[model samples]
Target: MPRPRTGRRVRTLLAAALTTLAPLVFLTGPAQAAPAAAGAWTPAPAPVVSHVETDDPVVFITIDDGWATEEAAGARQLLLERRIPASLFLLPDAYERDRDYYRTLLAHGPSRIENHTTTHPDLTTLTEAGQRAEICGARDRQLAAFGDGPRLLRPAGGATYNWPYHNADTRTAAPACGAEAIVMWTHDLTTWGSWTPPTPELKAGDIVLLHMGPTLEADLTRALEAADAAGLSPAPLRDYLLG
Candidate 1:
């Protein structure tokens, strides 16, 4: 039931065309993640955009996972009333399990959903095939369920990003899934409870992360209020990167 991705197909054809003309031109190796530095990639299919480097008056709020039965409703309500923008990195199965809950979130407006993974695994530990399965499989499910939902990839267990070693799939999975970027956060705000990191506050161009958890509602409320008091305007990740 997933909608076809015209862009993915186009990339496929373009690769073929370039392959046939190989004798006439030169090409660089595909962009990779291993030399995993701390920022965005220079080339297209750039897997990750950790933080934007502009003085724009925008901060980003991105919530991770879905079907968190305890706090999803409260989080959804807070997002709706505040009219603050947030980008949610969702697990496809989790969202599908509670379609009615997430459906209301979409209806509430001012939010966009992006990809987390199908089963939520550490991509650095998986083979390339496994990485693609996790990334593309989840995206396909999201498309099937929500009709073109989720266009960014956030590898599971991203908190350990500072760890010295990572496989190439960490970056390649983004393009493999036909995702725009491998989105990473500047701050993992633990105020609302945490699975990964504990960040202090929002700043201009900071990408904030929170999880769906017991304290999600209270944590998000405090964070949102603090962000407003500090005069930071929230925007979707896509808008900040593209626009």
Candidate 2:
């Protein structure tokens, strides 16, 4: 069930505050043992997926995770009815929570599941082995559930470290782990509330990111409307990438 919006807002604010405060508290404490200068670990460039570019009136809609209950089903139905294509970035564990639910989503036309890690973690902070495990494990689980492998990956939280975070080089982990492309959002509606859809602009090639929770249907509907207004039609991410 979706948490009350009021409560969720308060919790989000508190969590942000605590995240900001924790580092200060740690830094002010008595001098902890200074660690040796660590060897620089460089992040490899993220793989470039061709689907991100185009002059056509289309946008890529990507939904993350499998936690949405009826909200997801409604969104799937809406998308199918509209003949819109979308991609799902699934956290394998979450999908496991309700295998039948995810299968229902797959049964809906114009959708594909992609990897979002077995356990969502900061890949840059994780050891190479840890990263591989998280990435590959999710891929394996999705394959078992859906009878196919994911070709794209999106990192948790969109946060990166290990030097040059957004540099193309920093994104190599996913592809090396088997994903053919890495997806990042071009616009964020996080401030409007999770259930509220952002005003979508029907650019030739816009990649819109959304969560699986409340307002997903509303958001996608708004996005589709916006695309229509801009004289664009949504197309498959695969069309651009594999073509």
Candidate 3:
């Protein structure tokens, strides 16, 4: 009877020992989580800033329309002198009138060309198919003209109607047409026709809008000066868009 009792006690101790050792085995080699799927690229959602912002002291200069040749010349010269990168939103038809002129600007390393639409129609008034044609068609035309596709789209009048019968406005359709973003004016200096420069004090990440004709040089110069005062440098629009 004493031997039987001792044997039972021995069995109990062995069971306890196995239980403790089993936990140690698990602790020594932890399981690894599975690796992310191969070739999977998850992109973040587009940012909602009116103009992209960075901690760096940089601004974006965006010119709209291909209307004023005189202003375009002045703007190009000023931008080159300042060593600043600028973006142009051109009307495809307007550009077709003088492709070489726009191409000359595009040849500059700091400048990028994008779309303003085919004929500059108010996109909010058109139908869905019409909207697509204007938005996507403008991109196609721009790509054909510049050899580089447009990554940004600016709608005419910056308006979007809510009715389903009418096409979504340029503001709404720009993203739909595969534009990395839409551009709107933060400052309008009336440089093309009036030649008046806007007041200084423009801050970093500001998107200053100007036109092509005669007063472009003065307007751009004023804007640039104001930006400098605000401690901001000009950044190319391409930096913010997908290549």
Candidate 4:
């Protein structure tokens, strides 16, 4: 042995070994983490659907907004009594005013409350962030109140046509806000004041649109009758949409 190794010499040798290994330690750390970092992904936008193509004898009923307390009672009664699984796309304020109304419908019937935004705004006109706020804000409120989150989003405002006002941003924001589909309609039967829009001959996989107001009860009745005439029954929209 060349002179018993001094403590200082031993320390120096150990330091050199450690320095040589340090680059590998740093490199391995990042290499191990790279997979996880690369796995991160953003969700794709939800699809807009005006109709579902199916051969089953089924129709989808969707009601929008939550206003018209007295007028809505008849509709509520019909829904509960008939056990129609209508998708209620409601505004936050509408249900907040009378949570019990929706709660009871959900408790007793096959109906479910879905999202129509906090304030009904033309989603096509809103910025991406603004549209997200409206869509996600409604989802949060509904989840808090009902212990259930809305899976479908119906963009607000459509006139003389079935599809609601929406844009590319609406589709992108909808999925980000937890909506699976941006629901449009094949038939809009909303009645305004004394004017009742004519009902179309119902068909399988048709999406029927109605509103909560003075004519809801009548509209619901007519829709059911039309569905019956077409040999279609009202089916749960969520199940059909997902399937």
Candidate 5:
């Protein structure tokens, strides 16, 4: 029989529910969006933060899920050299394991680390209390580590069939946990596997997604170079969304 999932394993198994969704709401919307002002705390119209409709010339490079390694260490330097501004949504486990590693990225420059969650769970199936624990727990850890920035929750989600994945409870729990928005992605570079989507060219205000891994060095190098070739300047998600 298939192994009965438990705890974190259940999370891994349940996440498969989101495998068939193609989230491109913002980019598909109007070409012009009045940029938001600073200190805006409103959530995007969707429960997840896939992309935002903005009439700006800049694109955002957002990296999620930390798997610290020498490759990532080197990538941080490349980030500095290239002056790539990125938003990192870090899981508490990854952060705890590589606190100093990510701190180096934060210490170096404009890269900001937000919360992904405490235990990398699929929030859709969780109860209110469970969602709160994940969101609030991650926010607390991020604050303790990265100090302060945007309280955005980049819930541990990917897959397609699911849009936001986090149910109504997730919405209620996020603000309580200090998250302003539940950030998702518009385009993802599946660095861990061989299924990378064809990223033709990054458009203005597009949110490009990446994950930390052994392939990050090559993947980031390639992605940033593409951004440059496409004339899309990478910007911080905080400014692009909340202004």
Candidate 6:
């Protein structure tokens, strides 16, 4: 004979059914809000530019480090006289001794100060946080000294060897520090010691690298002459890069 359904049996069955359906109901019904992702989101890395690709008849002049300014008076005059829109990747310590020198360069011409890190350390050797401090710290100091923030970063070292030393961290750290591009050089025209590097035929989008040294004036002249030969005029790097 079949057993009749009892109240207890009914109650137990109902409870079991509720237990089985509860999870499904919970899952299908309006979902509970999830916790937000951890950590603040950072922006994508800025582009690394060794040279600009453009059709304009223009070249870029970049002078690294603010040291040797005393011997670079002629170079300074050339920058002002020609209104060259040179990107000055100056260190804080480099300009601390002669704020007026850089000040005059920025005040009179289209030249603008860019970041070269606070201590001029090879950024590839640093952690992301260390690189950020070096880059962002330099920016803060530059803003204080020049009354304008830097838009470009030229990482310390790499020019002499014609190879840029930057890792993934450098690209990320630069944007975090407000840099739009990691500017390297297409041609290093800087005069080291008694040796003057041969000036290649300047292309329309070539980036020339010079340093503030005893030969900066001569270096600038060589670069300008090369540009003239190639029918390229010096243009503002910042404008071109942003555009």
TM-score of each: 0.73, 0.71, 0.70, 0.80, 0.76, 0.82
Clashing residue pairs, backbone N/CA/C < 3 A, model 4: none
- TM-score attained by model 3: 0.70
Deviation of model 3 at 85, angstroms: 1.4
Off by over 4 Å in 3: 1-49, 158-172, 192-200, 241-243
Score each candidate by Cα lDDT: 0.65, 0.62, 0.62, 0.77, 0.66, 0.78
| Strongest candidate by TM-score | 6
Residue 238 lDDT, candidate 4, scale 0-100: 87
Candidate 1: global Cα-lDDT?
Answer: 0.65
Task: Return whichever of 1 and 3 wins on TM-score.
Answer: 1
Q: Write the per-residue lDDT of candidate 3 for residues 69-136, one digit (tens) a residue.
A: 74367677777777677788888877887887777776764788887777676666776457768878
Candidate 5 matches the true fold with a TM-score of: 0.76
- Candidate 3 or 1, higher lDDT: 1
Tens-place lDDT per residue, model 5, 1-243, is 222224234334323332334355422321122234354332222234566676676878888878765557777778777777788887777777878877777787788887777877778878767888887887777777778744667776534435456654565467667666667776776565766556557777677788887777777877777778888778887765552
Ranking by lDDT: 6, 4, 5, 1, 2, 3
Name the lDDT value of residue 7 in candidate 5: 28
Which digits, one per residue and each the tens of the lDDT, describe model 6 over residues 154-222?
888533433345666676678778887777777999878888999899887888999987999999999
Q: Which pairs clash in model 5?
A: 18-159, 18-160, 19-160, 20-160, 20-161, 21-160, 21-161, 49-184
Off by over 4 Å in 4: 1-41, 158-164
Candidate 5 lDDT (Cα, 0 to 1): 0.66
Poorest 10 consecutive residues of model 5 by lDDT?
Answer: 26-35
Per residue, candidate 2 scores C-alpha lDDT tens digits across 89-200 of: 8888777777876676668667888888887766666655567688888888888888989877777743332321122222434655667556666554332453454474
TM-score of 2: 0.71
